[model samples]
Target: MSDLATCLNGDLLCTEDATRLEEEEDDDEDDRFVFLMSRSAASDSEEYIRFLFSRERSFGDFGHAGGGDSLMRARSAAVRWILQARIRLRFSLQCAYVSVTYLDRFLLRRTIDSNQPWIMDLLSLACLSLAAKMEEIKVPPLPQFPAKNNYHGKSVLRMELLVLNTLEWRMSQATPFVFLGFFAYKLAGELASKELLRRAVDFIFAAIEGTNLVDFRPSAVAAAAIFAASGSPPTEKSMNQGMPIIESPELDQILSCYEIMIQAGASPGVGVKRKRLHLSNGSDL
Candidate 1:
């Protein structure tokens, strides 16, 4: 097995080996930062925006197969489980966002048997595990994952393989979080605080619960969240007052997405019942 696979399976490491792993992780972070910067630059291009819009349309037709309501319920449950795992594992919000992207994309292509709700939980666990491995310096052993679904470590590993195959190994997904920093910088300039960024991220997470918002591009969604959290209307004067004037297609898209968020009950101060799946094992999905 690869060293990463061995570590994920709970193998013991010597002190020197651990130190070496830490150094490797630091290098990986540097590489990741470079890649993210490149992606952020590309995302501003018309070609990249078109690609994201096309991909959104492809995935938007999901949740209509094999009992629509059941599928949505399952998806909602998986999202909740992912959220809980993020908290318990102390994972970054970016990790959770990428995992949710994987889960949604997988469900878009693969149909789950709704009668077997455990399948959804297994998928959620696999996605979360993959996200942790991608975004975290040190991931917990597979066996250490939440055991509510009675899923064995082997099951999670198998499901992880399936998810990887289903996603065509496109693990580094472009989520709203990827564009968040850029948008926040554009909106708040040097005045952006950790609290403001956190609130915007929370708004994005809440909006993710809205099925209608799934069709929006991640960039547009990120832009809308920042706009809403800033408490500024998307007017010509307001948007261009002290900031770079967002014009034409980009501005229109963000405003449109914000409107959708409002209609879907993702507006600030709006409370919508997030869908949940209640299975026999007291495990979500």
Candidate 2:
């Protein structure tokens, strides 16, 4: 609803409008997901944070050094699709974030051959569908997700299981958004205004969409986003508690991420959102 979202087509695209942006999805063949036992909803526990930061730090440079731009391009395209679904189907941005996490983890483990674009599209849809199921109650049937290729419900379910096994059922993970509030108040306290948080969300989303902040931990990105948004990092003096968010040893990492966040302000993955909304009413930024 702001100038940035309207101008950049951020996370504000309406459901009806988003549908108009793509072809109507085909009906999935009547196929039930096997071993699709109901799982616990996503929680921000220690394990979640561990899964996001601990497991992998070797995903590559997101470039052709792995081979070519094909993988990177596919990854970027999948993010766009997830964003569009988040806007259209009214899923929380957190769900989109989780979906992207699934996509990235899966891609890292099994690099999709450049020749198989359909695999990318299918996997993207499955990942988004699984995320919506995790983060929202009114998730549509698997066939409902718009995609370039018409995927069977069974196929999507298979991909979901593959993703699940590969991720070790890490349906929950910490994200940059989780620490935005903590850092804002830690740094600005009573003076923390909505503007500071808004700017930080914009910055975090932009960095996630590009290759700017992927290698850093979520806390680092959150601290860096606040630093980038409000003009400085949280100092030891600013901390009202035991440890500063960015310790002296970790200060270098935060600054590096902050520099990238500033450069990636206008990055393609920009998704400016005003509401700290939930998954149900949709549009979490």
Candidate 3:
């Protein structure tokens, strides 16, 4: 309770708060310099990175936390809806990420999901179309999704305007991939162990798969998952082992819930097969 109270009181700074303000300023300078250098390089890769970083900075300026985990919240269902729709429709991962951003931004303005799974595909395509217009030099034609579903072109165009109006014409977008990568790197510093870093990466990716699950809180789930996988304890660490060991039952519960949510959000299209080549093999189904 003391730790929680301290965290609530703002006296307990997360890793970032402990850093000197000067150092934080230096880091910002470094990010700016990197963007500038990349722009001078003038390659497609640089352009894409520039676009992402621009969007990230805009999110930060607008009080949106700039982390992949921030994009995931226990109370928010829209991100998961977009994610699930992308999976079901077999949309590219990059496109899915773009759609998730679009969906999140839209939710900032309007109520979303309302526990309805059926309308998700419609919302997902609309979000992706909006993202395509913003991110693509030439927007890709909306592909005919499936035999059973034919989204009206007029409907899509209408929804695009609705989304734009909902977002108040603020079109900057940021995906979680960059922030996730940075968070992993920072955790490596905190743990100072290669094995811990590997485990953290594994945990982040696993929790990311659960972005579709409503109960999964991105930042808390991410921190807890990484803490569990790294065998690290908060506010304490073994001198023998570099990484902190979070060996608490409460932490266990959080990690278990994360896994449960991921399983629940599992797409029906993919199945884990348990088959054996020999006669002694287990049931395939």
Winning candidate number (TM-score): 2
Q: lDDT tens string, model 2, 1-285?
A: 432112222231223421233422211100000001001112233455445444332333122124357778877777877777676666666677778877876665565665656677777888898888888878886555666556566666777777788777867666666666656666666666555666776676676665522356566777787778887654545432512524465565677778778887734224543334233557232
Please give the RMSD of candidate 1 to the true structure: 12.9
TM-score per candidate, chains pooled = 0.65, 0.69, 0.43
Please say which candidate is ahead in lDDT: 1 or 3. 1
Over the stretch 180-216, how does candidate 1's per-residue lDDT look in tens digits?
A: 6566666676675444454565577666654433355
Candidates 2 and 3, the one with greater TM-score:
2
lDDT of model number 3:
0.41
Clashes of each: 0, 0, 9
Model 3 lDDT per residue over 1-84, tens place? 332122223222123222111101122222332233223322324345445545544553232332234333422444544444
Worst 10 residues of 3 by lDDT: 17-26
* Model 2, residue 139: C-alpha shift (Å): 1.0
Residue pairs with clashing backbones, model 3: 72-218, 80-212, 231-245, 232-244, 232-245, 232-246, 233-244, 233-245, 233-246
lDDT values, one for every candidate: 0.60, 0.59, 0.41
lDDT of 1: 0.60
Q: How many backbone clashes can be found in candidate 2? A: 0
